[model samples]
Target: MPTALPHLPTSRLLLRALQMDQAEVLYRLANGPKIADNTANIPSPYTLQTAQDFITGIAEKYRAGEVLNLGMHVQATGELIGMVSLRLNARHHAGHLGGWVAAHARNQGYAAEAASAVMDFGFATLGLQRVGSQCFGRNKASARVMQKIGLHYEGCLREAFFKNGVYEDLLTFASVRSDWERAL
Candidate 1:
């Protein structure tokens, strides 16, 4: 795995490494009920310190070939819109995909576009054999993005995720290297 993070370009977005300067923007975009409720990891009261720590940790993770978390930025306006990530399991040559688009950026296809770019990097650049994603069962938009990216629906894991003091069903989706290649 390479130490340097990648810059993935889509038609309307630039997916790049998060910078320290963008911590505040990340905090603002992520510090909301809508985002926290849907995601497994992000806390509801997301603070600036959390964003800072994440940005700081991502570099080390990248260097260790453990993860890649890219900020989604609009190419035209250079505005930070969201984030996409791939957490690698080198032993299995697979990766777990995770991401979120800001409330203002939802329903615009940004999630699918950015996610596709990262999946491309994972298979083509990092030699990953499989990439998978899971979303809360209620997040229909996220499921759409997974399908749009050519990930086949696997199944639902009932009460697999614990978030916000409740159990939530998780819908899984995935694409192996062969399927991903055929899609391209």
Candidate 2:
């Protein structure tokens, strides 16, 4: 993706631009069995090639302003910890947030902390009227992160997503600009 994006800072983490050199790091963080089993689309057999392809492929999308993908790093050690992203839908003045943190980094509030900044970027910087996120119904940790970041649970679409040979309930959460602004 783009070599530079808005640098988002939190108490313990820094959300920086995604660099191609981080492909191996990302693959190791995202290719865990627990992560793939709980979410959709993360390949179980994650490879270096997959990481390279993604880093190379998304550059154009990032530069075009169609998407914002950030790399999460520990402020103290500069360790790449995870990622956060916001997808733009200009026509509808909306965007969607998606993110994942390494297993070692979970339960530490990193995801929620980074997500809050991204929500601000979506509503404040991108001028999106609304931003939303989706997680598998059984993905309680992810759901908690969404709620922790100020998104309210809107509803669920039963059997809406098929992952790993089974139909999954998709839980969608969102926050409008007015609500987000009021919360701050």
Candidate 3:
């Protein structure tokens, strides 16, 4: 099945597919120490060239239909402040949701708001049976976003995430379509 490109909205944000021109802004967000610590794939010193490479990879991934990576933009300023994604594995018909807001944009409910938009797209439009998220044990902010969006608190997998030369627990959270509907 061909997946549609879904553009979602919140009161002040628009979560749409990533564009090549968004590299510079994304570079700044991904390079932040706090943002890198919360994610497994983004390196610590995310450079402009690294962001360019990321944009290239995302372009390729979009063509392949392996993931739907969206840029979180402020509607008022027309700036790319972060990203939210719905990643699908074609073989299993299962997907994962993830997101990050720039350091300057934290504590304003942007992440949770953008994530809620993606969750609505996943369940209401895409017809996904189950969508979930994971966070590093130390990432309380991300965990809170999950809860704020109504995802259930699933158990942690002890020592499951090996990062920065040490093993850290990973907390898994999920929300089904029913749960999402109830929250609405």
Candidate 4:
């Protein structure tokens, strides 16, 4: 793991770099219909090959310092239950955020807490001026996590994503360092 990529801990979760050993957990969570429906970039019918490819390809991103892809794990069990990441850009001072919790971990506030920790890393540690997240307009749970971490409702690109044989609007939310500080 790169030292630039920090392993952040919340009360119930540890957000750290994804290891090759986590392919099984990634396969389970990333393949679920519910998880696929919420993310814009994830293909439906996610396969073992996709998981293996993802594990292999993620190394280049970490090496380049362009993204921080962290697995969300339960410290007690050392089980991989989810994933959270910061997608960086050179032209933009902000990073895009995303995550997915296992079916069994849903509604436990792990997403929000893990998200908060990553946002803190982005703004405080990485010196990003802002952090943003976008969700399918219908993904209330993910949108709620963004709001819980103090990301304001910025705007929505109407009918921006064509997925699952339908076009859905995308809701964009963001939080400045000031907003994050206030939330603390």
Candidate 5:
């Protein structure tokens, strides 16, 4: 199991562990309909307590080799712009990637940049054989991010996700280590 979450720096962003001090910022930026509507795990009414708890558990999960959740920040301004995560399945040498950008920072390629760094970490550092991601079919922005990060589209699972009182189709995407390396 990995002992620590390393800080990942991209050209425009820094990916690091979420800190307790940033709970308020996390709550302020994430507690909105736009973010919650697109993600499955984030609750509709994101609270400060939710942010604290999530941060509090990150270390333990990382120690267990189960999850890696990093806060995405702009390197120039040091602003908390979003988050990206890789949930591991060690037995299968695979991982599931997840992420979102703050509404204010959309369409700027930050999500793809940060996600690409994490995928590189997963495959190169963590020795993952494959990494996958899924988004609500309606989330074209997220799907684009997945593609931009080199994950090939898998298949859609019809009505596989139930969110906000409705069942929505889930679009899956993935890439094996060889394919990812070849694309680089």
Candidate 6:
């Protein structure tokens, strides 16, 4: 199974797959407490080697039809602002959404714009029945991003995420295919 990922161009950003040359940028921007603390997969003290490894693994994962990881870039400057992903669950026909924006790029709605594109891809291209996302409860901005993209708050998983040192609540939101179609 090929990645089937698309090059999504929005008004301000270009969403595409991770490139090998971006290891340094991914490290410089994503290797911090701000990003690492919130996401489930990104680890703090992120290293060039780790970024390189992830870049190399993208093709294989895409071929396996399990993951579609996209790097969000500024079209005019080509600077990487963030990343977004859709982790597919084949049996369930569902996709789990994840994303982040660089600290400097925050508050400008870049993450939300890219997320909306991914959600559209998950439902229209991947044929996922539902697309779900979550944020650590303390992160109101992330939760708002999910809500802005039309995901309804489902419930919270108490102490579900153990990052830094202690557990934090996880707020889940989801949007179904029918809802997406109806909106469009």
Q: What TM-score would every model get versus the actual structure?
A: 0.97, 0.93, 0.91, 0.92, 0.97, 0.96
Error of 3 at 145 (Å): 0.6
Please write out the lDDT profile of model 4 over residues 1-184, one tens digit for every residue.
Answer: 2446687989988888777777777887888758888886677788877888887867688678678888898988878888898888646778899988888889989899888899898888778888999999989999899998888999999998888789999999998878877877
**After superposition, candidate 1 runs with Cα above 4 Å error:** none
lDDT for each residue of candidate 6 in 60-147, tens digit (9 for 90 to 100): 7867878888999999999998899988898998989998998989999999999999899888887889999989999999999999
User: Measured by TM-score, how close is model 4 to the native structure?
Assistant: 0.92
- Runs in model 5 with CA error above 4 Å? none
Model with the higher TM-score, candidate 1 or 6: 1
lDDT string for model 1 (10-89, tens) is 99999999899999999999985488888888886999999999999988998887889999999999899999999999
Q: Which scores greater on TM-score, model 1 or model 3?
A: 1
Q: In model 4, where is the ten-residue run with the lowest total lDDT?
A: 1-10
Answer with 5 or 6, whichever has the higher TM-score.
Answer: 5
Question: Which digits, one per residue and each the tens of the lDDT, describe model 5 over residues 99-158?
Answer: 888988989999999999999999999999999999999999999999988999999999
- lDDT against the true structure, per candidate, is 0.93, 0.85, 0.82, 0.84, 0.93, 0.89
In candidate 5, position 127 carries an lDDT of 96
- Clashes (N, CA, C under 3 Å) per candidate: 0, 0, 0, 0, 0, 0
Q: What is the lDDT of residue 135 in candidate 3?
A: 94
> Comparing 4 and 5 by lDDT, which wins?
5
TM-score of 6: 0.96
Tell me the lDDT of model 1 at 37.
Answer: 82
Instruction: Give the per-residue Cα lDDT of candidate 4 at 22.
Output: 77
